[model samples]
Target: MAACAPDPEPRERGSRSPSASGRTARPGEGLLAQWDADLLEAAGAGDAASVTALLDRGARIEARNEDGRGPLMLAALADRVEAATVLVERGADPDATDDLGDTPWVTCGVTGSVAMMRVIWEAGPDLTVPNRRGGSPLHPASERGHADYVREVLATTGIESVIDRVNYNGWTALLEAVALGDGGEPHQEITAMLLDVGADASLRDRNGRTALDHARARGYGVIEDLLA
Candidate 1:
């Protein structure tokens, strides 16, 4: 559930608009801009050395791209574990959200990278933060049938409260799992994990359909039994 915002208009390298002082550039502004750009590039490329170099050169670790995604977010989105580690170790905020309110931790759920998840988690992200859809990372992980990611999220402290949190569409993690799942082993395992952690089977969606109804309608007998 990444945020969807129009990208900011592109700017030239080291370019700056005229300020109130009629100055097109300030002291060290060009250097900082270039460092930020390099940091983004290094992060996206998973070049830990370049990332560290940029950080050491006073690049703002939280500097965002046009989409409001910072270095850690880009690294997580790209599954660049090494770059993510470098950013986190250099004091990047793992909980930094993009324009869509999607944090690096939440992005890890989408990538289904346990290593990224662990790296971001160890950096102390706020697991309670919801994405733009008003769902926690567990929501996307569950919807995508990412059993391992779902388990890791549930294992996080205070994440149990997020399991039953409904999204903008009124589908909780369990409901999404049941609705979007293929009734495969992964889905079944996810369902079991949610249930074992006390996810309410009786929760309904915006259409007033419960997880059991979805399972039954989809003819997911195994899931139906679990919901029952």
Candidate 2:
């Protein structure tokens, strides 16, 4: 089996102004970065036309905000599929990561937007890339109860190596679905999908507890039955 990948922090992206570049403000480069900042705003706001115009005017497609979030990452975070499409068409990197190690593709998993997932997937994101917390895209999707995102990506990407993969904390996507999730409909759906796709039921977390154990501990009777 392929080695598992990791995850990033699950915190929301910081509220940044148009610019989020962590780079030192070079005195002479301030003005030049403004257009890039504009592009960031446009992408985040789903202004596809503005995004195109900025890029045409030589806005850095890779320009980042104060949070290290580039235009494409912002677009993904906001589920601005149109902006993301324009950015992708203009050579923006979907794999661009932010302060939290979240790329546009990884952020798609966070947003649970299957549409955004398709956009980033076509751009060929590195499925193996983990977030800051050492969790793969699947980890966030599973934990956050992105049932459709998990199901579609699993079907479309057809990459099963990530199914039973563990994170830095030794939690697999299955473990996360049970441990972090609230066992709501979405969470239950995600759990069922993971199991159906052959996620390793025998996998244990760093605490050496199975997913079934976690479900039972949390009174997730529905999940426990699934695990059983």
Candidate 3:
């Protein structure tokens, strides 16, 4: 499963605090401020050329906006795969978490950007790192039923241990999948896949609710049968 966090849209360039052009500027208001502003603009627009230009001019590759989103995260959220790639190549922190504790990979998964997800995942993020709620990327993937992403993570990375990891609520991937109610065939299949992959079906959450109990209470007979 793809565990991603909710990504908010970035602010437009023009809306940013501007610096006065040419001299006449105060210590805090000079070329540096404008450069910072431009870096954010390049990130928001996914203009790789512009970003490269700024970076060549000594722009910090890891510049954060007022909202605390790094260039890489902004690019990923915009589905700008190329720009994201460029940023990553330029030393952008793939594991940089926003104020909300979401990394670029998590944002990609939550936004259902399969292509972006692939890019970030390939860049080598520690997928086991939990979000603010203590659920890893696998938790969101299973919850949202992103089967392909889920399968890719499992196949391409060492995600088996992550699958059975419990969250703040002590819910594992299987438990979240069961509680997510039938997101469709993908969800059902993912739930089944988790079990088949040796997810601990007998494990219970903080409330003492096991995946088996969740499936049974929700009338998910297929999942219940799988657990049994």
| CA deviation > 4 Å runs, candidate 1 | 1-27
Model 2 quality (TM-score): 0.84
- Per residue, candidate 2 scores C-alpha lDDT tens digits across 1-228 of 997787854632332223357743332355557778899999999999999998876689999889999998989989999999998888888778888777888787788899988887878888787776677788888999888889899899865667877778888889999999998888899899889889988988888899999999999999999999
- Flag regions of model 2 displaced more than 4 Å: 1-31
Best model number under TM-score: 1
| lDDT-better candidate, 1 vs 2 | 1
Which pairs of residues clash in candidate 1, taking residues 3 or more apart in a chain or in different chains?
3-100
Summing lDDT over every window of 10 consecutive residues in candidate 3, give the lowest-scoring window: 22-31
lDDT of 2 at 20: 50
> How well does candidate 2 score on lDDT at residue 228?
96
Model 3 lDDT tens row, 1-228 = 998987977744433234466443222335556676788788778898988887876667777888788888888878888788788778787789888888887776566667777777767887667765788777877888888877776666677877777878778878888887584678788887787678888888888988888888888887777778
Assess every candidate by TM-score.
Answer: 0.86, 0.84, 0.80
Q: Rank the candidates by lDDT, best first.
A: 1, 2, 3
